[model samples]
Target: MAGVGLMVLLLTGCGTLQRGVDMARGAVFGPKGVRPAPEEVAASPYAQLLIEDDAVSAVMLLGNDDDGRTAWFTDQHVVFLCEGDLVCGTHGLSARLDDMRIVGPNPFVDLRAIGQAPFTVDRRYDWHDGYRYGVQVTGTVRRVGEEEVEILERKRTLVRYEEQLSGGVDGKNIYWIDPATGQLRKSRQLVAPGHYAEIEILKPYRRRVQ
Candidate 1:
């Protein structure tokens, strides 16, 4: 986690965490001009996050949530709250998914057991646009079968799912889940209409038994 300290320092030197992350995009990570190797990513427990292609490295905050939610932060400012690899809330994005509630069965919780294809789950969400809050939407998720994908040079098969939302927001939430670990390797989720987030879990967060 030595690199994490340097990343934090860069963010602290800059004004806001958001701005620091933006500046560090070119200054901190640009020297490489390419993605790091798999071994380097696996060396530290960090996840790579991207909101609309702008990339940033995130540190997972240790938690003991009974519901299995994990928190991730970038420069200790921007936050991404996840219910088992599925994003439930976000902060510091231009537009954000303020809150999300899975109404019935949480399909994301069980990647390996969703039987055949075309399964469904009910969900609701609170969104934050450039405007104000109180924006609510509901949606249904559908299983989209397994897909072969490569991440940082490693190839694997991942189960796919999508959320088609309506009633206030109109967009789709997509995910690629690793059946073995039940972790989302990649996801493209709609934060708000015209705004979405893409996250790649370069290195997954595993809590060290303390």
Candidate 2:
């Protein structure tokens, strides 16, 4: 009886010792060369918008929400991610910027260069409810002087510009542009009739390193 008890105790101790050795080995080498398969990356349109040397990527929070969404922009266009699953591209706004004659040390826009008379722009966007519609706005640009604005928690003095729009929608839009590079720092854009969104630049334009 005594010999059997001694044998059981020795076997139990050996079992515990083997468990400890296995745990130590796992910590050191993690299962002896077994590695997890790499996860497959999903393709995204927002990612495609970011092209080397062609566009810059940015992030902005929509409306008063806390969720951040990705955006990509070039000198000619800006694309935004809507609700994490939708992509909204606005080309009309970019066209307006391209049409303006920005000059001088202040890099101010000459509204007259947009044309002596008001011009109309039509934009189409798909709504969350699975419906597409056109928003028409007629507007002319004007300089609104320098103003202090906060972007990404940093205060910046930027040249302010205003667009007075009418037609299908009637509203005034504002933009704060960096005079040094003609980059838009902040904007309150009229998205739809009776609807608007405020956009603040969280990051400046920079080339992505491959």
Candidate 3:
């Protein structure tokens, strides 16, 4: 009951908009650093559509033994694709065709994509999923194929309330996004007792009309 009460107080006593702005700027540019205005970052292409939301799909061409494939709907529908029957008409159809379909709405948003800079880091607002609280903008530079790429990270907190209802959770979420395409490359969650989950982007694609 004590812990619950504390959570309620923290939520109700969150800092004002100015504080949020200061935190965002500090995280994005570090101390004594100047960054592009929040509006500019929010308006950048990096803030544009990261992936198809209304419809989604992808194929994972794993090695011979594990040739993989997938597809799903963005709205409220979910369907898993089978690898068989995918090559039915080709000469190697029998070898590559695996037809299967399981239903479930697509999972949560692409974490990496959600961490785009300016939108998450430099922006002057919070990104919530109606359940979790997300903040902190992280960017990393890495080598990709012969070129250096910059990636953004989004940190979120997941919540689960008891009978008190307004209590928040204590956890951390990290999202890795590719700035070049604004696609989510990976996502991670860390909770006390050291429980964590990671989702990696192996393949991605836009919806294709049949």
Candidate 4:
């Protein structure tokens, strides 16, 4: 009887030890071997808009609503022009990013230089102290009515962190493109939701400059 009890205890302990070994192996090998497939940028029109330039002049209207207060604005004036006389009220209000072009590399990469590309994919990879991370960002071209513009979205993942906290953000941006000129069109980031923020691109590239 004493011998049987000792054997049972030994088996149980061995099973627990094996489980611990499996978990440790998974933690070391799983994330290091996993890499997300690269996204294809050529399939989208927005990608093409990032590399071109437009030379036109036009009026752009920008509208924003926060906590019930709405504002309409344009690059011409920083102060949001009151749409209605009643302290601030506007119906069917919209704005645009005006007179811009795709020039060189994607503008979102560096603010100083005008860069052009058909489409843009921005990604970030980081690893430190047993932690790994990955982030995917993209921008492309879009057309609204007669306006030619670009749009963008960003996504991120914490693959190696303690808890999986994956999130995404959607944004509205516009790039005014020119047909034949190499000059840069105006660029504007509208409002929308991303990383716990509410934003929208009321209007983008509406006006044409002469």
Candidate 5:
């Protein structure tokens, strides 16, 4: 059964935006809770992705996967793409601001501001069979001292934040962010149930001279 499920996923890729939104609404909202506005649930992050930013383009390494996946970011979300796929079919996974417990800016989170405050995280997973899973977890961030990390072949010192999640799933995710920009430098985040991915920001995408 597990093998069959894996095969289906590889063959069909991820689910559609409508399916994902439907699942999110049903799973995230209770009888008394209000449904999210349509604009708030739109899946297309392309407009934001088009903004020219030096730090928007990145590379993410899947858990123990040798192939590196290309990551694109907007002010509100980050989308990971499958290599060599068609433009419309490149989306492998995505994370949005509405799903994140940000402290400062939309995507840029302030580690110091988070301190020991508890926050809620809602992550939506789009599966191959047109199914989506909304996982809600309560988490807290704490400063874990500083560490020297290499980015784009340059070593830099960064503060480490340990994000501990409970409620839906119990796990400890690590994040290293630039204090100056509050942008994530490296992260080991939970992408799905029982699955985690290691992500490191590579050099930003440079547009070729036309």
Candidate 6:
């Protein structure tokens, strides 16, 4: 929030009619820092659409796997396509990624089933940067152990996992998954070379077991 406030101070001096409203509220803070609650996400009397800083709306979930991958849009129609907690592809980002294919078995989708075991998964995606498009990236996924993380004055023990990605992009992808429900709580993934997306799932959608 301090960063945004400092930016507001600097940008406010510039003078533009629309710039006043362009400053963000719920958009700036880091995961370990101050973040909004679940209810603050949807300000409208209608759907969940309205985060103070940006034109951020509630999660606009798409259909099944083929139709969509749990997507949402923000800041000038920027869409993020997510498979569980991992961000697979993106639109409206500086360097775009498309056609993300997770080759073979993906155990990271459910840690409860896999039990935090070290695993490997390969992925292919189109890179808009110099790497070009449709290149493959190899990864070794493993549990880095558990730690206590505090969010909004609440503390929870979360298992931290790191994925060392090689080939197309060389970087580490980190994820925090809830062991009991086998759901992703938050993650930082590289959508393109040198470009990473820090995602925090304020509220996760889970299917009810009948």
- Models 1 onward score TM values of 0.67, 0.42, 0.24, 0.21, 0.45, 0.68
The lDDT per prediction is 0.58, 0.39, 0.25, 0.25, 0.41, 0.55
141-197, model 6: which lDDT tens digit per residue? 888888776643467788888889998779898888776676676677786777676
Which scores better on TM-score, 2 or 6? 6
For model 1, how does the per-residue alpha-carbon lDDT over 1-210 read when each residue is reduced to its tens digit?
454455455334322333334333322132212555767656643344433333433333322232345444543334444565666766555566766766667777665566665556566667645544555566566778889987788888998878777766678888888877877788887755776667667666664445
Error of 5 at 22 (Å): 32
Off by over 4 Å in 4: 1-120, 123-135, 143-167, 190-210
lDDT string for model 2 (1-210, tens) is 343343234323323212222221222111322222212112211222111111222222121111323333332233343322122433223212111111222212222233234433333333332233344445556676789986434578897878776764578767677766666656766554455545554433332335
CA shift of 133, model 2, Å: 3.3
TM-score of 5: 0.45
Distance from true location, Cα of 24 in model 4, Å: 58
Ten-residue segment with the worst summed lDDT in candidate 5?
A: 83-92
Model 4 per-residue lDDT tens digits across residues 72-124: 22222211221110111111113212111223343332222333323343323
lDDT of 5 by residue, 139-202 (tens): 5657787899975446889888776777656777787877776656677665544545455544
Give one digit per residue, the lDDT tens place, for model 3 in 78-133: 12222311111111111111121212321122322322232221111122223223
Name model 3 segments beyond 4 Å from true.
1-167, 190-194
Q: Residue 199 lDDT in model 6?
A: 59
Tell me the alpha-carbon RMSD of every candidate. 6.9, 22.8, 23.7, 25.4, 16.5, 9.9
